[model samples]
Target: MATKKKPSSDQGSSSSALDSSRWEVSCFWERRLQKELMSLMKEPPPGVTVDAEGAGQNLTQWIIQMDGAQGTLYEGEQFQLQFKFSPKYPFDSPEVTFIGPNIPVHPHVYSNGHICLSILTEDWSPALSVQSVCLSIVSMLSSCKEKKRPPDNSFYVKTCNKNPKKTKWWYHDDSV
Candidate 1:
């Protein structure tokens, strides 16, 4: 009689891990997010234009240009938004922030160019896309009840961490 060998636990675990990783790489959320971002390059938001400045021949990093929506405080302003996607994206949200001089000195946006948004922070979900982020920012700029910063804007700006991903922001208002 020939003896049959059973697969070891280590081998099974490794195989399962690989499969999970492969599945993550091909996840529906990632595909949807990428598709959405790509579509924006072709047909952008109203009055907004985005150009991809390839970060070393890879599409991981993008410098997006958004022409502030009309009837907004940012009207006539062309803002630069930086988007950096990780390999484990959709699971880990992209690192997005305003870059360079075009950044608006708003209540929600810090002087260092970090944006304060719920979705970018504690409220992030795999369902959200780059288009949604942009739309949210546009809406943010559009609904400026006043030109001044929020009452706690100074403290938030000073104490806030430079890395948007690491910072946890509280979302108090959904109206804007």
Candidate 2:
């Protein structure tokens, strides 16, 4: 059997190792997020507005406000979405959710703010940007006919992961 080495007490080896494993800022993603932010600021998408909620501080999180399309069930209503990016963003999808006093009662939106949009999950591609995600959400909301929650909303809300990104969503229904 191989011998197990004791962690060195002087170096606080175990704690140091754990610290190193913790998430840290990535220059690559930071630059990308910054560029995206600038583009959004310059020319925001229709029906959507984006801003860094952690202004002058963190850059990994963003707040998006969306207006329902004119001819949709949610028309004239407004909703807010929060997006949290990880160091591996672009390669990994952001944690997106509706953070609202008025979360939309839509077939794909949960009462607890979790959204079941495929692009935010399985359909995500690195080529997708913050602007595209916002537009996709707008399109999702625009395409809805009736204002209602998901069929399994209550059950899923009660037993779902707090981080929407953790759930393995099944994209079976396209007629949202």
Candidate 3:
């Protein structure tokens, strides 16, 4: 996790649980994010691509595009993903959401673009990368036989925090 400090005379400030204070993404983490970005650009997995220019200029935010995997329920469909990193990235999971025009309609996905994927929250680990997150999303969509929204879509979408990471998510089923 990122080190936290009260408002200070410093070079960087980041949003955290406490709105009154800010956190800093240390140089070590910046270099690590950069390295991961490079590796992803060089050899990304199938149906996944990142906006390198965006990622380079702003390490804390990224826009990713993922095409639905072949032979899957969502084949040929395109979806856009947005990832917002806090100072605690890799330690605190990124605020990931399906953005843009075509959000997939899987049971775990709300119309508001929030996805109910465990890895994006409770199951996240420092070992997971942006590439791995995309893969998991694709796998989630690929495994679905029905194209529908979550059962609580209406209520949740209306009440959830703009950042999906802020939600107290309850993951009941992995078999979806």
Candidate 4:
């Protein structure tokens, strides 16, 4: 059973107070994701577009469309990014991965669509938004001078968890 109440009035709900603990978690992330989605649609970052329809129906999952930046090794290529948010997002980071038929051949992106970006893992911050993440991904791709998979992409993909966020990412100072 579920009851609906304004987030501002969460504490005032007639429902069990014990449920408030769980309610608050969803409220926090829901509010943050709504704002982030609105801002992304209104003023999306360079070479990026949002799948507004997918977001409207399901706040937990989003499909982001990105165009490879000009002059980059992936120039003129297209890619889709899938962002899956947990109830503790903002405090935690979303599970982001490349999802379409045209996944880019980047050293950080495995053939299984998992990305090895630090912000998506150990270095995530509550201050970061979808726009900033998109920009970071764009920057990563734009700065790349060649198209190649990570040195350990095969081994990692073969034995890694389906959820990219679950893996302990080991970023090196020498990586792209």
Cα displacement (angstroms), candidate 1, residue 72, comes to 2.0
Per-prediction CA RMSD (Å): 9.0, 9.4, 7.3, 6.5
Least accurate stretch of 10 residues (summed lDDT) in model 3?
13-22
Report the lDDT tens digits of candidate 4 across residue range 152-174: 98899899999998898888845
Give the range where candidate 1 is weakest over 10 consecutive residues by summed lDDT: 6-15
TM-score-sorted candidate list, best first: 4, 3, 2, 1
Q: For residues 62-146, could you state the per-residue lDDT of candidate 1 as single tens digits?
A: 6778887777777788888888887667767889999988778677777677887888867778788777888888888888766
- Candidate achieving higher lDDT, 1 or 3: 3
lDDT of each: 0.69, 0.78, 0.82, 0.84
- Tell me the lDDT of model 2 at 106: 85
lDDT of 1 at 106: 75
Model 2 agreement with the true structure over 81-122: per-residue lDDT tens digits: 898999888789998999978899888899999999888988
Model 4 clash tally? 0
Question: Over the stretch 43-75, how does candidate 3's per-residue lDDT look in tens digits?
Answer: 998998999999888998999999999998899
Over 4 Å off, model 3 = 1-26
Preferred candidate (lDDT higher): 1 or 4: 4
**Global local distance difference test of model 2:** 0.78
